[model samples]
Target chain A: MRDSLVAAAFELFLERGYEQTTVDDIVRTAGVGRRSFFRYFPSKEDVVFPDHEQSLADMTEFLAASADSDDPLVRVCEATRLVMRMYAANPTFSVQRYRLTREVTGLRTYELSVVWRYEKTLGDYLRTRYADRRDGTLRANVVAAAVVAAHNHTLRHWLRSGGEGDPLAEVDRALGFVRETLSPDAVPAGGGTAGEQEAEDVVVVITKRSTPMWRVVREVEASLGED
Target chain B: MRDSLVAAAFELFLERGYEQTTVDDIVRTAGVGRRSFFRYFPSKEDVVFPDHEQSLADMTEFLAASADSDDPLVRVCEATRLVMRMYAANPTFSVQRYRLTREVTGLRTYELSVVWRYEKTLGDYLRTRYADRRDGTLRANVVAAAVVAAHNHTLRHWLRSGGEGDPLAEVDRALGFVRETLSPDAVPAGGGTAGEQEAEDVVVVITKRSTPMWRVVREVEASLGED
Candidate 1:
């Protein structure tokens, strides 16, 4: 019934425009009681992005489950995945919701505002994890900010592209970037633990700004021969 | 005139309350006409976050000037510093503003929405830098997010502690973590080269989880001894 109401509302929004649509019009069009519309969605805009409260609750649950992990980077990654999975499972709805959000200024603000809830929740968890470290507070805040940033980046790309491909890979790679960025010590297992070695030891050799991949590889190989 | 309006607004907000204070009261206290108040500030809440628009403009200008640099990471770090400098130059005002933002829910949301503008601006510049590289968009977004995250983390810590210490050092360290995380291969001159040596000639040793620092040092010394 609620889904139908939301579907009806979006249909009306497409047909008549968001400005012309109202709660009464939505309920009337859906053939549902006014109380039912209010019960399911608090306002007309709420119907457009109804899953926020639920997804936030879902994110809260995932973070709570992972709360005991001391691995701040891993914990943040897991919390971030919760959001990605929600979109992956419902790509069509998410895509439509994305379109609506991008077009509506109020909806866009509301969407961005929802991100803060995740940041705060993650930040709180981070504060607990880093309480003993000298820079625990700052680390937690950074970690939280990075998680939200990484998640939003992936989510936005997937959204902007019309949800066409495997976003999980992009999401993992992005999170991998954040994880490595925050905790370089955890570089992939095969990368050999020069994790302790000063990161400065690794020098990147690129041919020129326009260097081709094969040439870049040959240059790297040639450079390696010198040592 | 704008400065006086802001100062007067803050003084009044502190003495009375945000809701209780009116435009009439603010202008009367600041010795400005009602028309002058409208000319300077759009609303009472607008006066609370005066530097937001200007700071965003300054950051955009800094990034625009850095577009010629091939190093995207350097451009982002410099941009982050510009933002921090804006805050550092106004510690007292920022501290007071922080207090007001915390107490007012509407101001908090407004402040957050404005901060997103900074994040989006930085993220967009990063996107342009990484436009050609496959899988680069996600990496760029994450890097941008991490940069902002690092800045916000440092800023929040300074604000939360009542602006007690030099936040620039903290911001630098946080951003350093971000740079290292995102582009470990691009380490400075002292960091090792990115070239890979012949597998047979380079016997790299990784430290065990339980290995002591002294033992790891001895192992490195022994390996060099063989060479």
Candidate 2:
């Protein structure tokens, strides 16, 4: 009945504008009673998207299954992918919902509110992971934000591109950038050496014993003068 | 008028619960007309906020002033500090606002929405600074989230502690963790020199010799095998 009501709402929403559609119109088209519509959705705007409560529950379950693992970062990536898959699973409905949401300000804010809820969940998970360290709280915030950003960046691109390409690939690429930035210390082979850290005066020399200290000192002095 | 309304709302909210307070009740207490209340605020929920619009505009001006400088990261730090100072300037109101927001679900969501707006502004500023890089978007997202997280962490701590300490120092400490995490390529002088990278391996060898050849490799490999 809920699914039928959602389908009817979207159909009416498309045939007429969202503003032109009402709860009575939705029930009339769905062949369901007014009580049924109210039972399924708190408001007309809610039928346009998936059940966020269910998705969040699924995410919580997924996280709970892997709570013993020390890798919070990897688990977050997987959790985000789980959400992407949910959207991808029903592409036609997702696309229709996205288009409808764009046309409604109230719906857009509602959508954003849902996204914020997801971010908070991720943030909470991360905060728990980093609870023991002095900088755990800060690290959790960055990691949570980065994970959500990567997901959203890919999701927006996918939506903007008419949902034509492989969204998971783009999500992976965005996540890769995040992983590298946060974990630059794990920089792999052949990616060139890591950049310098400019905290204090530090000199690095790549030379053999045949090179004299006086020449090195002269070079250092010259570099300092240039600076 | 807005100020008086806020004071009245807080007073009523404390005396009665948030759920018990209505716009009509607030206006009656403030001795303002309904038109006056509507002119100043969109809803009763908006009364407890410190001028978010004004703070957003101030942040915009702060970012605009740093357009020619190279240190955008530092500029954002100061902009965030401006927000913290505003909260600190009114400890009683902030503490009361916190208590009310915590108790009211609608107010809590509204507060999250406002914080998300702040994050958006910070992210947009960072994207401009990191525009030329491959990971600029991802970097901006992480950095922005980190700033908000750091600020929120300190803000919550202060609010919980009755706003008694120097939160500016907390912000700095949080920013330092963020900056270091985002760019982790620190090198120490006169310490162990870096070694060649491998896909599954990274070697940091401490040696007195200046030569780079089989002897060094043998020493490193022999010691590494022991581990």
Candidate 3:
């Protein structure tokens, strides 16, 4: 019944325009009672984003259930991938909604609010993980925003391409950039091993050009020795 | 006239609640004609965010007038400070709007739209600067979001403290983290002189932990010799 209602609503939205399509119109087209349509969706706009609430809940659960990895940013990035998967699950429907959303200012605004909720979810989770760190709130907010921005960038590109190609691969590459660029561990600090060692270790050193090459070399050697 | 209208609207909004307040009541309270009220504000919600449009324009102009610094991200960060300045320019009103926005869902949603506009402005500027880069759009979006998130985090903290502390200083610290963490040049890449030589040149190198300390030393020595 819910699926039929969504189908009926999308058809009417496409045929008669979003503003012109009413609840009565959708129920009549679906051959369902008005109460049934209301049961499935509270309003016309709600039908446009049928899967968002479920997706958001799924994302929240995914983040909550994640292992306490040393790099919380990685967990946040993985959580966002779940959202991408939700869109990728129904490319045609997602594409249609994306196009429709562009035409309706209210839907666009609604979409932004939904995106903000996702960001808040991610930020709230990170805040708990980083509660002990100085500037944790700031870090959580920035990382959350970066993850969502990167995801939207890739998602919009995929949508614009008519949902062609591999969205997951594209999103992974974009998320990789965020992880590399904004990971807490990526910052320069004294070397300390906290998490399980990866196959490779990376050390980043920043120095002035005017400094002697020998001195820079010595600092690297010293840092590597500490590791 | 505009100030009086806004003042009247806010007073009524606070006393009678946002939903209960009407345009007619606002005009009556301000002792102004309905035409004057309409000329100043499109709706009751517009009165809550009186400075946003002007602040957005000011920010756009600030970005446009920025010197073509080699690191465009720095210029973008600087442009965001102009927004911080706008809020700091009037603390009492900013705090009142903040409180009212928190209480009203519509105003909160409207505020999110305003933030999106600001982010779009920043992202559009960055897209042009990074037009040739491989991940220009992704970088632009991520960096723009990061700047806004960091700014909001600090601004919210200031607001939650009842507008009591130094917001600009807090914002600077937050933006500094963003700049240090996400700047394009912050990544480890081969050194090359591009912009005006600063007082000091910085070199960053990343290498596998398994690499022999001696080998790591040699690579740095070798790279320094080329310069």
The best candidate by DockQ is 3
Q: Model 2 clash pairs? A: none
Write candidate 1's Cα lDDT for B1-227 as tens digits.
99899989888998998989999999999998999998877878888988878888998988888745558887888888888888898898889889888898878878778888888888888888878765566656666766887788889889989888888887888776665445533322122222221122222333333334355445444543454
Give fnat of each prediction, in order.
0.31, 0.24, 0.80
Instruction: List TM-scores for all candidates, in order.
Output: 0.76, 0.78, 0.89
lDDT of 1 by residue, A1-227 (tens): 89999888988887877878888888888898999998988778788877778887876776677646447668778877877888888888889888877787778777767888888888887788779865667667767887787788888889889898988887887776666455534222223212233222232332222323344344334433333
Clash totals for all candidate models: 9, 0, 2
The C-alpha stretches of model 2 lying farther than 4 A from their native spots are A67-70, A184-227, B184-227
User: Candidate 3, A40: how far from true, in Å?
Assistant: 2.8
| DockQ, Cα level, model 3 | 0.57
- Give the clashing residue pairs of candidate 1, or none: A181-B181, A200-B191, A200-B192, A201-B191, A201-B192, A202-B192, A203-B192, A203-B193, A203-B194
Query: Sorted by lDDT, highest first, which candidate order results?
Result: 3, 1, 2
- lDDT (Cα, tens digit) per residue for candidate 2, span A1-227: 88888888888988998999999999999998999988878887677764787888888777777765647877888888888888777767777788988888778778877887777788778788779755676677767777887788788768877788888887877776666456523322122332222112322322222334344334334433333
State the lDDT of candidate 3 residue by residue for B1-227, as single tens digits.
Answer: 99999999989988989899999999999998999988878877898998889989988997888666657777877888888888898898889889999999999999999999999999999999989876888889999999999999999999888888888898888888887667575442222222111212345455665667676666555545456
Error of 2 at A97 (Å): 2.2
Q: Which portions of model 3 miss their true places by more than 4 Å?
A: A189-203, A207-215, A222-227, B188-203, B207-227
What candidate 1 gets wrong by more than 4 Å, as runs, is A32-35, A67-72, A132-134, A180-227, B67-71, B132-134, B186-227
lDDT of 2 by residue, B50-122 (tens): 4888898999888877865656677777788888878888888888888888888778778877887888898
